[model samples]
Each structure stands twice: as C-alpha cells, then as structure tokens.
Target chain A: MSHTLVEINNLSRFYGTLQAVKDVSFTIRQGEVLGFLGPNGAGKTTTMQIISGNLAPSGGSVTIANHDLLEDPRAAKNQIGYLPESPPLYRELTVNEYLDYCAALNNVPRAKRLSARENTKERCGLHDAGKRLIGNLSKGFQQRVGIAQAIIHLPPVVILDEPTVGLDPIQIREIRALIRELGRDHGVILSTHILPEVQTTCDRVQIINKGELVLNESIEGLEHHMKSASLTVAFHQSPDLQFLENLPGVKSVHPEKDGRLRVFHETEQNPTDAILRMAVNKNWGLYEIRPGRLSLEQIFVELTSDAALENAEALATTTTTDSGL
Target chain B: MILTIGIREFKSLFLSPLAWSILAVVQVILGFLFLARLEVFQLYQPQLMAMDGAPGLTEIVLPDLLGNAAVILLLVVPLMTMRLVSEERRNRTLALLFSAPLSMTEIVLGKYLGIILFLLVLLLMIALMPLSLLAGASLDLGLMASGFFGLALLLAGFAAVGLFMSTLTQYTTVAAISTFGALLLFWILDWSGQGTAGGNWLAYLSLFNHYKPFLEGIFNSADAAYHVLLIITFLVLSIRRLDADRLGG
Candidate 1:
C-alpha cells in the first residue's frame, strides 16, 4: 500500500512570462488510479508532458520507479506509457503495423515484440481492426489504438491525457471501464475535466484550477468531507425561518418548494434529533426527514468556482502593483 | 531502434501514391534525357572519332545525362523528404516520439537513412541506363562509379536539408518549398561567384562545385569530404531542432 511509483516534486513550467504550472507536487502509488481534473489551460497537459519526458520543466524534479526523469530519461521513460491528448498515430500504417512499431520503439525485446503487440491490441479492443488503416478507423477505434500503443510494452506507469474526449457516451463508458481495468495492475494518471469520470473511474481525485492544485482527496473523502452536512425535511405547515435557524446545532436553514426546509449543521453534529424534538413541541407537523447527499457536479462547481475567485483576487493585486497603485 | 523507425518509414513511404507518382515521373524524365543524349552522341560519333582528344561514350554522354539526373534529384528529393517530419508534426504524431524512450539522434538518423534507402533504389534505376552500353562499347567503369558516388552523396545532402527544414514547421508544402529554396541557393552561389575575389569562398560552399570534380572523372578526396561535411552539418542541425522542441515545449 505504501509503494510509490511516481513522485513529482515542485514541478514548474513557464511559457515565456506566463507560468503554466507552479510548484506542483504529488505522488502516485502502485495500483492507484489518480484522476487529474482541471479546467482548460490549467497546466494539465504541461504537467503530463513533463512527467512523460515530452517537455522540460522550468523547475523541480520527477522520479519514476527511482529513475530521475531529467538525469536518466531513457530508463524513466521506459517505465511510463503515455497517451497524449491528440492520440499521436501514423495514419498511413495499419493498426497492427503501428502497434508493432510502438512496441519496438519502447524497446520490447525482438522475441516478445509480437506477443506484446497482440496482447495490447486485445486489451484495447483492437483485435478486430488489426489490418485496417488507422485513418480509416472510426474516432473511437483510433482512440483505442492510441491506448493500445501506449501499453504495448506493458509499462508500469500509464499516463493518459483526455483519453475520452470526443468519445460517444457509450464509448466513454467502455473506455472508463477499460481504464478501471488498467488501474488494477498499473499506477494510472488520467486527466479530464469531466466530474463523473473521476467519480466512476478514479479512486482518488486531484483538481487543478488556474495552474494550482485546489483539491486532492480520495473519492470517498471528497464525498464525505466536502459534502455539506444537511437534512431535507417536509412539513404540513412551513416553519418560521428564524425558529429553525435558532435550533440546537442548526447553523442555517433554507426553505425549499412544497413546504420543505433544508437544515445545515457542523460535519460532526446531526441537527435532525433536535429539529424533531422542536417540531413536536411546536406542533410543526413534520412529515419527513432525510439526509441529503451532495452530487459530484455540485462539489466540482463549488471547488472550481472558489479557486477561480481566489485567482481573480490574486490577479487584481498583481495588476495593482504593476499600475503603481 | 533506428532500423525499426527506418523500416516503418520506408514501408509507409510506399504505402502512399505520392511516392509512386514521384518514382514514375523521375523515370520518364530520365529516360527521355538519356535518349536525347544518346542521339546527340551518335550524331557526333564520326566527327569525334576523326578528331584528336575526342571524348568517349562515358566522357561525352554519361556526364550530360548524369548532370540532368542530379538536377531532377534536386526536385524529387525534397518532395520525398518533406513529409518525413513535417507531416508527423501536422498529424500530431511527433508526440509519440517525444514520449518514447528513444533519443532524438535515433529518430533523426532513422528517418534520414530511410529516405537514403529510397534514393538508393532511384539511383540504381538510373545507373542501369549507363551500364547497358557495356555490351556494344568499351565504357569507363571508373568514371561511371565516381559519378554515381557523387550523385549519392549529393542526394544524401539534399535529404538532410529537407529533413531539417521539415522540423521548422508543421506545413509540408512550406517544408518542400524551403528545401528547394535552400538547395537553389547552394546551386546558384557557385555560378554567381565566378571571377570574384571575396566570392571565391561562396563557390566552395556550393553543391555543384564539389560535384563538378566527380562528374569530370576525378575522385578528389577534398570534394568527397565536402559532401560528407555538408550532410553531417544539416543532420546535426536537425537533431538539435528536435531537441529544442522537446525541451522548450
């Protein structure tokens, strides 16, 4: 449980004067599926590029299975299988030829290259499209080939950048299932802006906004910690807002449609018992009391919006300094 | 790793119609030029035989035909080499190379050798035209070998330049035109530098000036070295360009 496969320390990347990634640090353990969520242009691709040895970082270091990326790129890269955002493929070659080339490029031994190619093709569901030209394949199959090539050598660490973009809903579901399967054997880092993707496929989630890591937690932790502790109750007659707000352990109360009120409380405290006692004493005619679960979309919106507001405030202060205000 | 990339590149080249079209076009043009040179040589055969210091078939006909072939190669090599890197970049397939464990040198050299192999096939086809005269006439094998050797080096240099230009942009057409433009600069600089003091060095930089010795049946080591140096310089520049892309972006 404690074996770390990838350790990224204080990674930074600057494009001219604009900082793309700033001092980002994280570690991924073996057999852990880490969902890297970020808004557009939030340095997700840049960070993935640096870890895969495609781009150089402006600062910091990355180690893969104890191999330093900058000092020994070949050994470090050999441990990583990367699928970039666009699915880098040679359109002229057939699926089999392309995978064979990829296996060779990743330095699979000559004797095992054929078996490795066949196994990867089977894993990515490309067994039927072996002889088909890559350009002629549908977008979904092409994306599969992209994944097939990445895992041709059976690398220990697999990095996929926006693997499900432009995929049909069904295809997205299938790919998500495939990613989940991959997670069982290899440490996987998947980047996406889709909230449900992380919920369904990832064991842990890390969200980046404005080039900064704003949220990092297990899926269970995100559901339990960031979720507001609340109960939705319906009454035969509406309760006074001040009466419910002043209830023991009740921090705030929001009235909903159909004579219902949502009562909030601290994470460690449940106000339902106190609300029930108060309702009976006042003859509030309460009919139902049910705990509410925060939807993943709500959590995503709240976290990203909060990060955006902080970024805006930081930008304003920098602009003020530049203007000599 | 280099052979793997080279084999893939070579196979992919034949997989497209553009490579076949180029091969057909080169063959037709070279055949017509060879026939024209042969006719001219036959017409002048009697007068040349009667005159002192008259040039033979190898000296008179082969050089003219080969010079024309060299000019045609200037056009054909760029078209062949333009897509080597530029198309990969345009199609966004270069990212595959970046993430792989292979070094930049391996990729560059592998692609270069792949194009060189294609050009070798083209050279073999052209050489058969000159070698066919062996049955009827006594030909200078030495002169023909030197000419073929020079053309091979010259084409290798052209491919190097094309490969380098391809790395500068994602547009294949732009790569093709720039490679043609760069070769033209090297070709014309020799002619333009005629009889000038400071311009003498410019002639040395020209591809034709180094090739002139081989065309004249003189195997000058200095001239051979020139072509080798030119090929090495452009290939090194290509490797450096790829490295910058990996490091900077």
Candidate 2:
C-alpha cells in the first residue's frame, strides 16, 4: 500500500459567526485521486485553503508528509501544490516566466529550475505557448499555465479547486486526462461540484454538504450504487398494475402519467425478465422499456438536501430546548 | 525565495506600461525643473561674484532641484507602490504567494524590495541632472551626496507607507489615494505645528522636517533614524497585516 501524503483531522473553519467548514477529516495516500465533491458553499474551497495553508483552520490540524501545517508551515507547504478556484495567475507574465517564478518560489534548485519548468510545461501541454503572455492566452491556456505553476516543483500532493470549471468539453476532457495521469504518482485532491468528473477522474469520492461530509465512498462502491435496481416500461395497452406488483422479484410498481409502469425490484433480483414474460403472455403491448438508475446528480441533490433538512431539524430542536430552559 | 519573488515583481512592473509611463513623466518634470533652476542660477551668477562667502552654483541650484525631486517623488511613489500588493489581491494572485512555502515577511519584503529597486533607478536618474554640472562648473559633491541620500530615505519611507496602504485594500486607486493622503500629511505635518508649544514634537515627527536637514547638507543620525524607524514600523505593520489576513480571512 502507498504511504499517506496528507492527513486532515477534525478540521473546522469559521467566517465570523458562520462556520464555513465543520469537523471534517480525510486522508489521501500517494497514488490516490480523492474527489472532493460538494455543492457551492459546502466548504470544499475552505478546506482546500486550510490544507494549502492559505487559510487557518479554527480547529484540528493538517499533516502533509509527516509535517504539521501550523507548526512547520514551510516544510508542510513544500509538500503541496495548490491551484485555487480562479487559478491565481499573473496575466502580465509569459507562461515560461510565470512557471519559472513558481518553481523558484517552491524552492526548486536553481540548476534544475529550467528543466522543471520545461518538464512541467510539457506535461501541461504548454510547450507551444511558453513565450505567450498569460493575459493574451485563451482561458484554457491560462488554466494550463495555472496548473503548470502548481506542479512545477513536483510536490507530493496537488490540490486543485474546480480545475475544469469554465472550460470547453474538449479542454475539460484533456484536463481530466492530465489529472488522471498525475494520480498515478502523486496524491491528488480534485474539488468540484461536477459529479461525473468525480466518477471519471477520482479513485475515491467525498461528498460534503452544509460544511459536513455526508458520503465517503470508493469509485467501485459508487458504481455499485449506480447500478439500476428499477426498470421503466411503457405499454400501448394498459395492464393491471396490481398483477405486475405481484410478480416474482418485483418490490413495487407505480404508474406514470404517460401510462408507463415503473417497477422497483430488489438489487439481487431484477424483475425485468419476469415482467417481460408476463407482458408478452398477457399481450400488454409493451412499446418501450429502459433500465432506470439513479444518476449521480440525483444522488448529490439527495445527499445535500437531506443534510440541509437534518441541520434545520437540529437547529429547531436546539432553539426549542433553549426556550424550554 | 524572497529574491525570487522580488525579481519577478520587479520584472512584472516593467512589463506593464504604468511603470514606464511613471518613469518617463517623472524624468520629464524633474528635467524641466532642473533646467529652470539652472537658468535662475545663471541669472544670479554675476551678482553673486561680488559678494563675500557667496553660495556657488551647487548651493544655488542643487538643493532646490533635489527638494523638488522629493516632492515629485512624493506624488510618483504612490503611483508605483499602489499596485504592489493591492493588484495581487485584486487579481487573486496573492493566493499563489500565500500557498507557496513562504512567510508573510518574505512576501512583503520581496515586494518592498522590488519597488525600492525601481525607485533607486529613478533616484539615479534624478542625481544625474545635478551631476551634469561637473562638465564645466565645480560642484559640492558632499552636499549633493547628502541631498540624494536624504531623498532616497524619503522615497523609502514613502514606499513603506504605500506598501502598507496597499495591504489594506484590493483597489489600486484607493491604495494610491490613501498613500498620497498619508504621505501628504507627513509632508506638511510640521507646517501645522509651527510656532505652537506642541509643534516641536510634531515638527520632529514630520517626514519633511527630517528630510530638510539632508537637503541642507547636514547628516544627522536622528534624522536618518526617523526615516529608518518609519520604514521599519510600516514594514512590520504590513507583515502583521498579511499574517492577519491569513488568520482572519
């Protein structure tokens, strides 16, 4: 097993009275791409900032490569390369100049700074635009320069907040591929609200809502959750929904407005074949049938909304108890 | 790391038209003022030849030229230092420095040094106007050195104030205006205190009061100390302000 590159324990942050990040914790081992999934204002950026030492956490600690962030910031920060949500670019600087400056800032040895810049530029597909000023480059190229600066020093852990945001489909795909390639050797933390991005680029996914982590699962486990346990069938002729509900492996049946039946079944016992056999024998004139699976978007919405509801209930109870007191 | 940031900041300034325009405008204004002083000195030369222990061309022209340079720099330094930290904050590029393996002290000092280096170039150009008298007229090199020394200290002091002000806001124009307001107050502080019982300390506190002795060719350690102290205090405040940002932000 690879060694852990980052360990965050019970981290919390506050903006005045508003707590931006709650008691959240996670770790990233080398060669792991951990997706930090959250809706807007769910504290993903705040957590990333605290880890990168851009912001101080109100509680708990972060350790990077065995160095405590608060106690040994230089050593701890040396292990991280962070690309903030906006890329933190200097538009007046050319790509090579900016990357060289970043390498120097990261304390890359003077003798090796050039090769580091060259290698990082090559890796980020910035070879052709080395001499171009960042202000003059396209948004995609500017983002590439941002990523190039982050990784120029070859830090052990890279934290990217919304790296693919505001990019075209092809640019997003290229960035995702680059991130996956980075994951092979470095522990990467990719923060975004884009659900499928996590599915494609991350080995593990974490969903945070209302400053709290609601779900932490591996990609394999998420894929299992994504498997369809329900099927939808539209019929040209109406059938008794009760008969379909009584079929083997069928848990329940609900009729749609368009005269379709949605069949919910147990995970291990798919009722598709049974329903098909019944439909054919009864001559129900089934016109369309499709496997129904809960999308990642739906899962994200459900998790976030559920967390919000729970927080509201908890807040209400606290207020009521205060009144009772 | 400080040098790395310092060099990048310095280079980036030249990459923008603002620095170039500031340099050119200051040079033209100072040059015009220098020639005007030379013309006035030429007009007074014959009359002064008959007087005993009369002030020479250096005494007649250099101090006034240097004094005007100080005032000109008072206006120009803010324009230069306004964007030092504020622009980084505005563009969100400060995050790059914040996340780097650097202390706030290093970041502040790096930027401080970059602008100071640029100001040094401006100072050199200003000094050349006085030195040009060396071709024909004998000059008081000592007085000229002290005058330039004092101007350099004043510029450093102005830059420190400007940099600290830059840290307080993300808008460069606001930073520039606030810095100008602060420096202007320092420039005329002694004016309000003149002839009053409380004016002695206020006069002593005035940046102009300390700088005046240098233009007069007197190098008092106390005057030097004031500028040094101002530079150090404002720089420390800047560092603290950035540290506070990391904590409170």
Candidate 3:
C-alpha cells in the first residue's frame, strides 16, 4: 500500500460570516499528483493554505506524515512545501541570493545549504538566471525561482497554488512537465482552473464547488466518465430512424446537427459489430464510426452547471423560508 | 534561520533608494546641526571656562547633538522600519515564511534585528561627526559614550514600535504614519503630564523621560529598564500580531 503523506479530515474555513471552505476532506499519498480544481472563490487556495500550515481551519485537522499541523506544526510543516498564488519573489535580490535564503529558512543545514540551493536551481531550470536580479527577470523565470524555493528543502509533499497563472503557452507546458516530474518523488497538490492541466499532469483530480468537494476521481475514471460507450457514426445516406433505434443493444439514438448519428449502447454491449454486419449485408455505405468522448471542458461545464442549478434551488428555498419567517 | 532572514532584509535595505535617501538626508541634517552646536560651544568656550565647574566639550556638544539625533530619529526610524513586514505582506512574501518551518518569533526578531543593524550603521556615521571634533579640543569620552548608548536604546525602541505598526497594516505609508504618530505621542507624554496633577505615571511612560538621563551622562538603571521594557513590549506585540494572522486566516 502507498504511504499517506498528507491527510485532511473534514476541514472547513470561514472568513467571518462567509464560509469559504466547508467540510472538505481529502488524502494525498506519496507519488500522487492531486489536482485541486475549483471556480473562483471555491476554497482551493484556502484548503492548500491549511494543508501547508499557513492557515488554521475553523473546524478540522490536517496531519502531515502523522504529525498534526496544529499540535506539532514545525514537524508537520518541515515535511510540506507551499508556493502561494503569487510567486513571492524578493525583487531586489538575485536568484542565487533568494534561493539561498529560502534554503536556510526551510532549515537546510549549513553544510548542505549550498548543495541544496544548487540542486534546486537546476531542477527548476534556473541555471542562467542565478546572477540576475528577480526584478530584472521576466515573470516566467520569477515563477521558476518560486518553485525552486518551495522544493529546496526536499519535503515529502509540495503544494503549489496556480503555479502557471500568467505564463505563455510554452512556459505553461514546461512548468506542467516540471510538476509531473516532481510528482514522481513527492506528493504534489497544485490548484488550477485550467482543465487541460489536470488531464495532462494530474494522476487524480478533485473538483470543489462552493467549498464542497463535488468530484474526486482518478484520471482514468475521468476518462471513463467521458467515454460513456457511445459512438458517433456517419453514413453516405441518412438511414431510417426506426431501423437505427431497433438495432441490437441500442439504448438511444439521436441525429446530430452535423449530419451524423449519436448512438449510445447498453452498458454491457458494443453495437459496432452488429451495426457493421447489417451495413455490409444491406450494402449501405458506412463512412465513419468512432468512440465518443467528451472534452474535459464539456465535462467541467456539465458538472459545474449541475452544481449551479442546485445552488440556485438552495438559494430559492432559503429566500422563501426567510420570507415565511 | 533568523540570521538568514536578517541578512536578506539588511541586504535589501541597501539595494533600495529609500534607505540611501534616508541616510543622506539624516546625515546632512545632523551634520549641519553638529556644526552649529560646535560654533556655539567655541564662542562660549572662554566664558564657560571661567565659570565654576563648567561642562566640557563632550558635555556641551555631544548631548545636544545626540538629543537632536534622537528627535530626528523619531521621524526617520519609522521610514527605515515601515517596510519590515508590511512590504512582505504587500508582496505576498510573508507566506513563504509562514509556510516554512519557522516560528513567528524568528520572523519578528530577525526583521527587527535587521533594521536595528541598519540604524546602528546610521548611528555610527553620526557618531563620527561628533568624534571629528577630537582633532581640535580635549573631549570627555565618558560623557559621549553615555550619550551614544542612550541613542542606541532609543533607536532600538523606535524600531520595535515601527515594526509592530508595520505588522498591523499592509500599506507601508499607514505603518510609517502611525509609527510617527505613536513616537510623537511618547515624545510629548511628559510635556502633557507637566500640565496635570498626579500624572507622574504618564511622565514615567514617556520615552524621552527615560532617554534624558542618558543624554545628561547619567546611566540610571531605571531609565535603561524603561527602554528595555518598551522594546520588549513592542516586539512581543509584533510576534502576537503575526500569530493572529496565521490563526485568523
């Protein structure tokens, strides 16, 4: 069994009267990259802050490597690293000087501080920018410096908040690859609203809506959710709707706007073979038949839209109760 | 870890134009004050020598200059210390320290010490202007030493108060303004007491009241204790403010 590196149980946070995070719970293990997904103000950053021991939750506890964040924060924090939404770059210092300070701040021993700084700089691809002041460097290099500081102490868990917020496409891809590389050894939790980032780099994804965990599943499970055993097929001629509906194992059939038929089969059946046989025997031209999979954007829209509907209903009921009261 | 933070803070101070500008303005004003006090002392030297038990050059020049230095520091120390934690919060870099394995005490002490070191450097330069008079006259070194010691204590206390104010707000201007206001209040606390009956406690709490003994070449233990207590109080308040931030978030 994989070792649990960070465990959060029923965590909640409130900014005065506003409930920012409510009863959120999740566990992250060694070698697992957990993608924390949420809309704006969905408590992703707050949860990450709690896990990093930067913020105290109103109600629940966080344990890092069996040490409680509140009871033994030093030991717990020593095992976790966090990069907040902003990179936190000290503009006046050179990259080398900033990283060295971070190394010492994270309790890297005097004997090992130099080597650790060098190694982290190399890992974050900050080799050439070491001599340049952070203020003089571009945003991309500043971000790399941010990552270098987070991992200089070699913690077991690293939490990054929006590590790729304002980067070019190539820079975003590089940072994503770097995150994936870090996940190979450390339990990495990154908060991002970018859906494709999760599809590419995350092993598991947790989507939170209104401070509640709405979806938590592996990437494979996400793929399966999108791949509903449906097929989009097109023919040279439009076939009878009744004949298509009467096909074996055909659960539903609908004609799409682009002159193709969307056929959803029963859970246990693949109707491609039966449809292919009938098309050959009847001499009906069949051009294409491909497995259907929803884009991550579509799935995200669907999930959040459902959540929005529930939220609207909840608001309506609360308003009605308020009026009755 | 505290040394690391202190070094970073001290180094950043030199890199900013604000620190340089503060240093230049302060040294120029204090230098001008030093010259004015020296010319006045020289003009009265013969008369002062004929008087019974007249004060020497150190007694006449050093105390007045250091007193002016202290008053000037009342306005300038806030500028030096206003960015200690406020700028870190503004830039969101305080999270780096919070998320690290550091206690709030380390952060507060490190930053406080960093600014104190810079203020000490300023104090050293101002000390040189007074010591430059050694080439022309015989100076009482003991009296000068006491005056310098008092200025050190005053600057440390001022730094602590400024640091606490910085922790209260993310806007550096607010921190600087409120710190100036706080120091100004303490400076005149004794003056306000002079008008009221049975307000000795207010005078006792006055920062200048504690500092005045040192300026007069008298090392009173009670005066020293007051400055120590003031520094400790502000530093403790700063540490608690940072703790509340972690908890409140």
TM-score top scorer: 1
Candidate 3 lDDT:
0.90
Top candidate on lDDT is: 2
Local distance difference test, candidate 1? 0.90
Show the lowest summed lDDT stretch of 10 residues, model 1 chain B: B191-200
TM-scores of all candidate predictions against the true structure: 0.95, 0.92, 0.92
Question: How big is the positional error of residue A77 in model 1, measured in Å on the Cα after superposition?
Answer: 0.9
lDDT of 3 at A157: 97
Q: In what order do the candidates fall by TM-score, top score first?
A: 1, 3, 2
Alpha-carbon interface RMSD for all candidates, in angstroms: 0.9, 0.7, 1.1
Candidate 1 ranges beyond 4 A from true positions: A226-228, A256-259, A307-325, B197-199
Write model 3 residue lDDT over A76-191, tens digit each, in one string: 98998889999888999899888888888888898998899889988888888889999999889889899988999999999999999899999999999999999999999999
Candidate 2 Cα errors over 4 Å, as ranges: A228-251, A265-291, A307-325
Model 1 complex DockQ against the native: 0.81
Give the candidates in order of DockQ, highest first: 1, 3, 2
Which pairs of residues clash in candidate 3, taking residues 3 or more apart in a chain or in different chains?
none
